[model samples]
Target: MTEFNDKQIDILQAAEKLFAEDGYDGTSIRTIAKEASVNIAMISYYFGSKEKLLEALIIHRTSGMKIQLENIFKEDLLPIEKVERLIDLYISRINKNKCMYQILHFELSTKKRIMDMNAFKDVKYENLQAFTKIIKEGQELGHFRKDVNITLIPPTIMGTLVHFQMNKPFFEPVLGIKTEEEYENYIKNELTAHIKQTIKALLVHEN
Candidate 1:
């Protein structure tokens, strides 16, 4: 993953916050400039336009995750252990970048037809292929059931994590949590444990 300079990082952070607060259509170059505390020309100079800025943010955040998952999949560990580690990686990444995920969830849900989702789709496809390779290796090694669908596993894992994040208003109160930090901790530990257990069961269960 390429390291972003402090100024670029500042712009991406500001864009993420604004995109979360206002839909992409509602956010503007001027707003981002103001929030980032940089002039409008700087944003244009860093990223050509609002659409491109969104793409850059998504790429920057997801690149590290892709590398981490690829490394985990390549680790000389048991298939089952690798699966557990993959779950941990997903939860940790999503929890750390809640804002980015929020933007993703919102964009797909509300602006699917209009927004340029090509970059996002490409990244998602690449990650899914990497994950499928891991699952296939496990099946070949007799660690996972042959009947398990590779395609469904990624959505199963991601959906569960994204659900907890997007439904915070509903879940935080249900879980009886009051602060964001507490909720993050619960997701990182308790929720992560549950997801790992569920995935392991699905992978190893007998027909």
Candidate 2:
């Protein structure tokens, strides 16, 4: 991941917010500059183009997760504990970066070419590999079942969280959420616990 200065971070964040709300085609470089309180030239100087800006934002948001997942492998915890930590890490990251995920879902759904698709896919693949490494270690250690579908685990975690976020308006009422804090707590607690339990069930072999 490329290092970004304060101004660059500001521009990327502005782009993320606009891209989530207005769609990539709807958002312009000028709009991002205005939102960031910087000039168009600054955005151009920092990112080179709108497409590059989107690329930078995508990498900026996702690169950290891959690094964190790799670091989890170094921890002295049990395999299942590490898996639980991975779940918590993902839930926490998605909850915090809802807008970025929203932009990704929309862009990928529409099959847009606004950003570098290969770069996006590379990040995703790397993250999946990191996750698969943990699962393989668990299997080798006789903690997790050998039959676990490595490919499905990433989507299972990501899809569930994305679904909850994208359909929040509907789910909030159904779940009896009334305030912002309450909703946040529900995600941090109930939602995280649910995902952990679900994944553990899939991986843990019954005696």
Candidate 3:
């Protein structure tokens, strides 16, 4: 695997930051060229276009996760460990750049026709497969309830963690949290712990 040259990395990083801050429609190749300190023709030469560059960023970020989750699901780990680690990686990935999450969330609802689902379909399906497969295996091993809807639970877990920030502010005042950083890490850790506890309760046989 060859390395990304300084110029290539700069364009990539600039694309992620600008695309996140400005949204897809508002971002342009010239702006990225300016932000990256590269000529517009150079970006076109390396990455084709701004749209392709954005797709590359999402793919790059999620690819590591796809590989990690695949490894975890293949191991002989316990059910609760599987669930906990899944949530852990998911949150840690988000924590790396919370702003990117906002960019992605917006893209899904507003730019679907242009962005289409294919840009991220694999990542979504890969995660759903990992969680549902784990749930099924756990059920067979008497860790999870056989009657539980594994598919529903997996997506529900995703929806909850992803949207927790959106709901955090409304509930934060009643709970009296301080700065945004405090609220973010608090939710990240709490969400992981809560998911662990919930899965623990779902276990039919405790070891």
Please report the candidate that would top TM-score against the real structure.
2
Backbone collisions counted per model: 0, 0, 0
Clashing pairs in 1: none
Candidate 2 segments whose C-alpha is farther than 4 A from its true place: none
In candidate 1 the C-alpha lDDT for residue 151 amounts to: 80
Q: Per-residue alpha-carbon lDDT of model 1 for 112-133, expressed as tens digits?
A: 5466767777777887877887
The candidate scoring highest on lDDT is: 2
Model 1: residues with Cα > 4 Å off, grouped in runs: 1-4
What is the C-alpha local distance difference test score of each model?
Answer: 0.83, 0.88, 0.73
Cα lDDT, model 1, residue 128: 81
For all predictions, the C-alpha RMSD in Å is 2.3, 1.6, 3.2
lDDT of 2 by residue, 171-205 (tens): 98999999999988998899889999999999999
Tens-digit lDDT track of model 3 for 12-105: 7888888777777888899998999989999888778766776666666665566688878888899768877887777777767666667777
Better-scoring candidate (lDDT), 1 or 3:
1
Q: What is the TM-score of each candidate against the true structure?
A: 0.88, 0.93, 0.81
lDDT of 3 at 157: 59
